[model samples]
Target: MTATAIVLLVATALSSLVPVIVRRRLRSTLVVDAVTTAVMVGFAATAAALAADAAPARGVGVVVVACAAMIAAVGGGGYVVRLVLWAGGADTRERARDSATGDGEHVPDAESESGTEAEAGPLRGGRVIGYLERAAVAATLLAGWPEGLAVILAVKSLARYPELRAPHAGEQFIMGTFASVLWATAMAGVGFLITH
Candidate 1:
């Protein structure tokens, strides 16, 4: 049992680390997202399963799992955010627009769609912000300073105040932020379990 536990813990850390190296250049968008998301879920479940290990990680093991925890926070968190957005039907309208615009098919835009000019385009820098956000969240939780999470979140919201006012941006912002923060917290919990 002791050997099994150690092996599992090591495996968990390595599994989490390996997927980060996956080239996200897959041919299909759906396939790329699905694969990454699958790996993310696998890491989470693996970490959770190893929560009851007989011994906490020591030496370099702690570092490895700590890195893995961050991996889970960023990648898994993204997938969760995507799921929440999809469930909320937040982008459905944009996605379902006239597919017939190309080729021989012709479908005119409705009046509402025609006159609509984006005030400043969709929120830019979201991907970069998400990475920084996840890193900050995971680091704070791992450092045993949970209060830093609140500060980080407050800063993010305040910085994006103008963009958040855009249509659907509020929903996207809230759901994405919540998902990342929550995912980071959970993965940090797993990191804490193994590292401490």
Candidate 2:
């Protein structure tokens, strides 16, 4: 790998990791969101600066950069989705937990604060779903099988169909899923860039 590729790879890795560290270190969603935005911008600037270097990474450098891109796809989507949700005024907070069940499931509804597994709460478990969705999307793209995106979308839409009827659920689902898939595909593109 050229020095530019190394720098770009490092930038990609930072993009993948900095938000997670900032989110854990800071309590302010605003600040963490700001950092996420900044990291993305920084990554773009770094990539642009080195974009002229069309030399693909070789051997271990390819593996390392690809891994960084995968991490960005899987882990970075949370920040992207969170930022979108926050900007759109969606309630990004997890629903109130049920004390009775000892599980972390959301409080079901007005009728039941105790939260049975059957009830669909707003944006419940969305974080994990987003992560998994992005992971799958990233993996498929990185594997050179773009058709996996259709399967991923179909599965998610079908699975989320029941909960889509709830208030704000459809909006959140669409926004989050769009942000997530975009982020994953973009990161996968970044990974591809490392090869060319």
Candidate 3:
């Protein structure tokens, strides 16, 4: 790798670390804190890839088109997987333990406290939206948007604070690992396309 590539790689790695460090230091959720880091890593990876590739400008154009197509396919695939998972009755958030208290119980409905019947959740709609969200997220990596993608993931991680806060250490580690790998792939993918 060239000096610039090395620098970009280092920068991407460091960016990925920022959210985890911030969350840990703040005693807060890893999800939110790490979003920005992931996005930056993606961007850095793209830049590094572009720098490393000796392709001519015309070749760059072709790469761009190819990368876009690949990203779309990956994003679509992720959505399809999510949809299938949803159709199979896979979501179990209702059974998930409350992260805050480790209480294996659902929070009482707000309407019940108001002496009214509880409302139904939009579970199906939520599942569809979740798939769309993942598609968008995964697509960002495949597109020439690794940095932006990382940021998006970091934001998601932050938003998912409720899901992760007070998680078992093993759970948190697993999540971190997954996030790292995903972001790294995005960076590497975009970079490879840009450079080649």
lDDT of each: 0.63, 0.71, 0.43
Off by over 4 Å in 2: 19-21, 94-121
- Least accurate 10 contiguous residues by lDDT in model 3: 119-128
The digit string of per-residue lDDT tens for model 2 on 40-108 reads 757745664464466877898777766777777777777777778878877654223334345644433
Write model 3 residue lDDT over 58-139, tens digit each, in one string. Answer: 4545455344433332332222333233333443233222442476434543443585533222222332334344455545
Candidate 3 overall lDDT versus native: 0.43
How many backbone overlaps does candidate 3 show?
16
What is candidate 3's TM-score against the reference?
A: 0.30
Prediction-by-prediction clash tally: 0, 0, 16
Tens digits of per-residue lDDT for model 1 on 52-103?
A: 6646777877777777677667656655565556567655222333233434
- Measured against the true structure, the TM-scores of the candidates, in listed sequence, are 0.71, 0.78, 0.30
Worst 10 residues of 1 by lDDT: 92-101
In candidate 2, position 69 carries an lDDT of: 74
TM-score of 1: 0.71
The order of the candidates by lDDT, greatest first, is: 2, 1, 3
Residue 41 displacement (Å), model 1: 2.2
